[model samples]
Target: MTTHSPHPVRPGHGLTVADAMDPCDYQIADDSTVDQADNILRSAHIDYLVVRDHNGRCEGLVTRTGLHPFLTGSWYTERTAVSTTTHQRGPFAWPSMGLSLAAIAMRVKRLAVWPVVDDDGYLLGVLTASRAAGVLDAVTTP
Candidate 1:
């Protein structure tokens, strides 16, 4: 009698998504409007804001690209502060995700920035696609 042995599964290796993602990332409150997010983006020199809840958990993300349209036409007024319109939904990735996966998501989604979350879905940090690409280029070129 011949018995077949079970195949052993290989564990995941390499840099997890958290490794590629920034941990001490900036975040904005959900109560903040589009206008506020825009000003913060410009001053902070960032394209995306991780929207946080009252408890400081990440809820969503707002991008300057999404806020730009609302500034045009009558939608915006002179008295309107950078806190009027609501921000767009946020995109997030898990820490266990691979760098390659993150890179693919950034390219296919055309995302300028992506937020990294913990196992509990708590906000971790922001990952700029440009920065990631630059780092990758440096590593691969050398």
Candidate 2:
């Protein structure tokens, strides 16, 4: 039997990408020099940074490995790290996914981190496995 509840499901309300993501200021502009980007990454103490363009659009990702080649290259000091990102990103965490079993899916994947993007592919934020677990716990706890 279908029982009526006071709060019905909304289209897109809770646990959205915006809610689950660990908001960070670790985005590096695409035009920034490799040195500049490296500094940011170092200061943030993170292995990955969301790569954004002039319009603040998600271009790709910049990881420690992605920057490895440049570290040994002669032009490393002069080149931009944007082009070194992993173009074919593994998975993107969309805000809409949080509506369903997306968080569970990510947890199952065991990804260290992933990017959260909007419909327009803008840089929303980053998501970590621990953060996803926290969301799952919160949703299941009560």
Per-candidate RMSD, Å: 5.6, 4.7
Q: Model 2, range 48-139, lDDT digits (tens) per residue?
A: 87778789877767777777777777755666556554443645777667633665666676556777888788867777777766765766
How many residue pairs clash in all the candidates, one count each?
4, 1
Cα shift from native, residue 91, model 1 (Å): 5.0
- lDDT measured at residue 73 in model 2 versus the true structure, 0 to 100: 76
lDDT per residue (tens digit) for residues 8-106 in model 1: 533333556665677655677766665667777899897677778767777767677667777775756545433344554455787777766787888
Q: After superposition, how far is residue 55 of candidate 2 from its true place, in Å?
A: 2.7
Off by over 4 Å in 2: 1-16, 73-77, 87-91, 104-110
Candidate 1 runs further than 4 Å off: 1-13, 77-91, 135-142
**Best candidate (score: lDDT):** 2
TM-score of 1: 0.68
Best by TM-score: 2
TM-score of each: 0.68, 0.69
For model 2, where is the 10-residue window of minimal lDDT?
81-90
